[model samples]
Target: MAYHSFLVEPISCHAWNKDRTQIAICPNNH
Candidate 1:
């Protein structure tokens, strides 16, 4: 597993086709 440093206020994914965006987040201590 890899930990990435994301500095954005919130990481968001946008879909142009009206589909839902996908994201993975750590749940326990994230």
Candidate 2:
């Protein structure tokens, strides 16, 4: 599978919206 990087920070977790049209991510910077 091919993945894309939209965030510059390392992501700890991610979630997609109900329609899967948007995303929410938690970065490991904190």
Candidate 1 regions with alpha-carbon error over 4 angstroms: 1-20
Best candidate, lDDT: 2
lDDT of 2 by residue, 1-30 (tens): 113564544445766679867767665532
lDDT for every model? 0.36, 0.56
Taking every candidate in turn, the Cα RMSD to the unseen true structure, in Å, is 10.2, 5.5
- Worst 10 contiguous positions by lDDT, candidate 1: 13-22
lDDT of candidate 2?
A: 0.56
Model 2, residue 29: what's the lDDT? Answer: 31
How would you encode candidate 1's per-residue C-alpha lDDT over 1-30 as one tens digit per residue?
Answer: 222443342444321234423345545325
Q: lDDT at 3 for candidate 1?
A: 23
TM values, all candidates: 0.20, 0.44
